[model samples]
Target: MAADDIAGLIREAIPDAVVEITDLAGDGDHYAAKVISESFRGLSRVRQHQAVYAALGGRMGGVLHALQLTTAVPT
Candidate 1:
């Protein structure tokens, strides 16, 4: 999938999130994403990552091969 598609999915889940998606390998299968949202403020790192993965709705191991994900609360 495309970077924009990934970003869109995250945005849809977290309306106020700032999502930046990078195509790490330039192959469209490897990606790096930085997600910032107020909703993540009190969540554990694993939970934050889970929220993101949930946004993808099972696309992670399927259509999306690899994703380097970093999530944080808005500064």
Candidate 2:
């Protein structure tokens, strides 16, 4: 999927999130993303990552490959 499509999935899952997806591997399968959301304000790093992963559904194991994720609570 395209970077915008990955970003769109995040937005669809978390309406308040600001997502930026990058093609780190340039393979359309591996990606890096930075996500900012109020929902992550108090969540731990792993929890935050889980939230984003969940947004991707089952793609993480199939269509969507490696994802290096960074998450933050918007200031």
Candidate 3:
């Protein structure tokens, strides 16, 4: 639930990704993550989000409650 935990999960899934996570609610549950990676180059926004969600390994709607995710390809 910590910011590092969220960033760690994303980094684990996308090894080359640059992850920046912010604790939105200061409660360790709500977060906002900005991910930049070459892997997301051709993926749609939804697909990118899905990838992030998958990276969480089913923790999206469970232990992690809310996440505002933004993904982009590295320029």
Candidate 4:
């Protein structure tokens, strides 16, 4: 999938989230993303990543290969 398409998926999953997605290279399999949302407030880093993965509905396993994720609660 395209970078923006992947970004959109994340946004859809967390409606209140602010998502920034970037393809690390030309390869769609690798990506870097920064997401900020109130939903992440009390969640640990691992949990935050898990939430995003859950939003992808298992796509992370196949369609999406690698993701470097950063999650934060809004100030």
Per-model CA lDDT versus the true structure? 0.96, 0.92, 0.92, 0.88
The estimated TM-scores of all candidates read 0.98, 0.93, 0.95, 0.91
Question: For model 2, where is the 10-residue window of minimal lDDT?
Answer: 57-66
Query: For candidate 3, lDDT tens digit of each residue in 1-75?
Result: 788988999999999999999898898889999999899988899999999999999998789999998999988
Better of 2 and 4 by TM-score: 2
Off by over 4 Å in 3: none
lDDT tens string, model 4, 1-75? 678887788899999999999899878899998999999988899999988888888888698998889999999
Which parts of model 4 are misplaced by more than 4 Å?
Answer: none
TM-score of 1: 0.98
Among residues 3 or more apart in sequence or in different chains, the pairs in candidate 1 whose N, CA or C atoms overlap within 3 Å are: none
Query: In candidate 2, what are the lDDT values of residues 17-66, reduced to their tens digit?
Result: 99988898788988999999999988999999999999998789688888
Candidate 1 residue lDDT tens string, 1-75: 999999999999999999999999999999999999999999999999999999999998899999999999987
Candidate 3 worst ten-residue window by lDDT? 1-10
Scored by Cα lDDT, where does model 2 land? 0.92
Error of 4 at 46 (Å): 1.3
Who is ahead in lDDT, 2 or 4?
2
For candidate 1, give the lDDT: 0.96
Model 4, position 36: C-alpha lDDT score: 95
Quick one: RMSD of model 3?
Answer: 0.7
lDDT of 4 at 13: 91
Angstrom error of the Cα, residue 42, model 1: value is: 0.7
Clashes of each: 0, 0, 0, 0
